[model samples]
Target: MAVSLWHKKVIFFGGKGGVGKTTCSASFGLLAAKRGLRTLVVSTDPAHSLGDIFATHIDEEGQLAPNLWGYEINPVKESERYTEQIKSQFQNVVSPVIMEEIQRQIEAAYSAPGSEEAAIFDKFIDMLERIETEFDLVVFDTAPTGHTLRLLSLPELLASWIEHLIAQREKANRLMSMAAVGSPELKEKTDKPDPVLATLKRREERFRRAREFIVDNQAASFIFVVNAEKLPIMETQKAMEILVKYQIPIGGVIVNRLLPTDQEGPFWTRRRELEKKYMAEIEEQFGSLILAKLPLLPDDIYGRQALDQIVQMLEEQIID
Candidate 1:
C-alpha cells in the first residue's frame, strides 16, 4: 500500500493520554526513516515518554536511528528562552524608564497560566517552519486531546490577536507622529517607523503563515489515536469536532490496543464483548476515518526492536 503520510510534510498524532499516541508517532517516524525520508519525531506533551520509548535521551534533538531524530520540547526552557528573546527585542528601542516597566510587565505575564502554551506554540511554529529544510517529514506526538486541541488552535487565535495588537500599535504610532509635528527631531523619530509596530507586524505575519500551513490539507494532517473504550471514543469524537472547526486536515484514526479476537475464557470473552460494543460505535461514528487497528502487544513497547512491530502494523494496515 502507498503510505499516505509519506507525502505530507507535517503530521500530528494526538488523542487522550495513555492511548499510545507516542508509540504510533515513533513507529511512523521509524518507518519513514527506514524509507530514506529524513524524519523528526517531536513530543509536545509536557509529560514526555518519547525518550523512554526510544530508550534514548533526547533533550532538544537527537538521532535515534539513521535519518530519524527525536525532540522533546521543554516548556520551561522554551518559555525562558522566549521571554529573553522578547526582552531583547525591546532593548535600544525604548527609553530606560519604559524598558524597565516593560520588563516588569513581561515578567508578570510569564507567570500567567497560558504563557507556557504560548512558548510551546512558538517552538511548534519553529518545527513546522523546518519542514523540507532540516527534515523531510515532521511528526508531532502531541499532548492529550484537550491540551493538544488548544495548542493546535493557537495559530488561528493568535493571528487575529496579533492583528488587533498591530492595529492598536499603529493607531498609537499615528498619535505619536501627530504630537511630534511641533518638533523636527521628534517628527524625524516618529516618521522613521516604530520598532514595536514593526515587531507586531512581523508576529502577525508569522502567525498568519503558521495558520496557513496548518490548514493546508496537502501539507499537513492530524491522526488521532483512540482505544475502543467509552471515554476515549467520546473524547475522540469531541476532539474531531474541534479539529474540523479549526479546518485542520484529519488524516485518519488509529484504534489502538484492541483486544485479541482469539482469546478464550469468560473474562476474555466479556472484555471482547465490551470492546465489540465500543468498536461498533467507533465504526458508526468514524467509519470513513479509520486508518488502522493495533492489537494489544504481549511485551512492553520500548527500544527500536519493539517499535518495529508497530511499524510493521502501520506499514501493513495504514489506509491512505
Candidate 2:
C-alpha cells in the first residue's frame, strides 16, 4: 500500500456498502492527527459505524482520540439549529403565526429527500470555514456511493435554487414597495420586507460561498474506498463519473481488504491470485489515482493499536 499524495484537502471515503469505508476513514484520521494536523472525521451515513471502528462509544460529537474529533450528524439537530437561527432573526418581522409556519417548513425540509443531504452540506461548510483558521484537515466517512454522490452534488443544485430565490426575493421587494402606495392591503404586505429579504440574501451568500469552497481543489477532495470485488469496483467507477460531473476533485481510491501475497497454502494461493487479478483491474481502471491497498488482517481492525497499523501502511507511500 502506498501513502496518500494530498494533505490539507478534505478527504472523503465513499463506496459500496460493506466496503470498510468507515475503517479506512478512521485510519486516515488517525494518521492525520498523528501528523499534528488537528483532524476531524465525520460520518454522514445514517447507520454510522465510526464508533464501532474506534471501539468507543461516541455521541453525536466526540473526541475519539487526541487531535481527532468525530461526529455523526443528526439531521434533526441541524434542522433545529437552522430553525432557531432563522426564528431569532425573523422574530420581530414575521408574526407568531408565520413563525410557527416557518418552523414547520424547516422540519419538513429536513425530512424531505434532499434535506438530510442539505444538513450535511451545511455542516461541511461550517467545518471548512473553521478549518481555515483552526484545523489542518477534515476527513469525511461518507455514506455509500449513491448517498455520497447525492450529498456532494447538493451544493451545485442548492446554489442554483438559492440564486433563483434571491432574485425572486428582490423582485418581491420591488413589488411590495410599489404596492405599498396603492392600498391598505398592499401596505401590510410591504411593511416588513426588510427582514425577510435580508435573511434570504444572507442565506444565499452563505450557500454561494460554501458551494465555491467545496468545488475548489485547495479546499476539498473526494476519495472513493472500495474492496477488490466486482460490485464495489463498478460502484466506485460510477461514483467517480458522478463526482467529475459535479466538478468535485477526485483525490484517490483506497482499495481495502486486499489479500496478502504471503502465507503458503492452497487457499492462500487461490485468494492471492484472485486479489491480484482484481488489483490489476483496479489499477487499469483508476491508474495512478489508486492511493493505497490495505491488506486484510487476521481479525477485525479496531482500537488504537490496529488503527496505528493501518497508519503505518499509509505512511509507507510518498504523499505528493
Candidate 3:
C-alpha cells in the first residue's frame, strides 16, 4: 500500500558527464507536467544546459509552461550571493574597527574549496523545501555523479562540523565570562546569544531537514541517465552503489543514445557491434531497473516538437 520511489514527488537525474542527463530530465518534467502535475525541473549543474534543452529561458522562479517550471543554479553567481549575505550579516554584528579584516576573511573563505558547493547546496535545499508548498513534483538535473554524491552527503558532514563550531564558541564564551568575573560589560556580552553560532545552528537545522526529506521520508528519487558505453556503465554502477550506501533510493536507469539497428558501412557495422556488447552489459547489469532507452537521433534534439517526441516516449513507456 506504499508508493514506489518512481511515483515520488521529487526525482533526480544524474550520471557521468555527457550521458544526456539534462535532456532526459527535461523530457521527464514536460511529461509529468503534461499529465496535469505541476512539475518544476531544476538544474544544479554550474554549466547549465537545462535552459538550452528547454529552448526557453528559465529565471530564478523557473517558468516554462502552463504546468511546467524550470531553474538553473549557477555556482559562481550563487557563491557571490552567499558570500555577500554573510558579509552583510558580519557588518551588522561585528565592531566597525574589525569590519575590514572580517571582510578579507570572508573573501578568502568564499574562495576556499567546497565553498561554492556549499552555496549551491544551500540553494538546492531551499528548492526542496519549497516543493511541498509550491508544486506537485520536482525534478533535479544534477551535475556528474561525484559532485551530486558530495552534495547529497553534505547534511551529515556539515551538521557535525557546525555542531563542533557551536560547541567551541560556547566554550570560548564561557571562558571569557570566567576571565571577566566582575566586569559588567564582558558579563553582558557573554549573557547575549552569539549571533554567529546562532546562524550556524540555523543552517544545521536546515541541513537536518534536508537529510530527512532525502533519506527518511523517501521524498526524493534518483534516476540515473547513462549511455550504453563501458565507462558510463561502470560509472553508473559505482554511483548506484554510493547512493545505496547513503540510503538514497534509486528510481530507475535510462539508457540514452542507442545507435540505429540498421547499419550499412564497415565503420557503422563495427560501431553497432561495439554498442551491442555494451548494451548487453547494460541489460545484464541493470535491466530490471531500466526505465527507458532513447535512440541517437540523427538531428540534435531541440525545440518543443523534438522534446514532445521524448515526452511521448515516456508516456508510452512509463507514466501513462
Best prediction by lDDT: 1
Q: Estimate the overall C-alpha local distance difference test score of candidate 2.
A: 0.79
* lDDT by residue (tens digit), candidate 2, 191-307: 754777677677677777766766777667788888888889999888888878878888888888987666899998988788778888999999788888788888888888888
Runs of candidate 1 with Cα error greater than 4 angstroms are 1-3
Estimate, for each residue in 1-320, the C-alpha lDDT of model 3 and write its tens digit: 43564457789999999998988999999888877888989899888888787677776556777798888898888999998988888788889878899888888998999889989998999888877689878899999999999999898888888889989988888898897799998888888878888887888899898888788545778889889788999999999998888888888899889998886899998999899999889999998889888988887778778888887877777741
**Cα-lDDT of candidate 3:** 0.85
TM-scores, each model vs. reference: 0.97, 0.89, 0.93
For model 2, where is the 10-residue window of minimal lDDT? 1-10
Best by TM-score: 1
lDDT against the true structure, per candidate, is: 0.91, 0.79, 0.85
Assess the local accuracy of residue 29 in candidate 2 as a C-alpha lDDT between 0 and 100. Answer: 91
Which sequence of candidate numbers ranks them by lDDT, best first? 1, 3, 2
Query: What are the C-alpha RMSDs, in order, of all predicted structures?
Result: 1.7, 3.1, 1.9
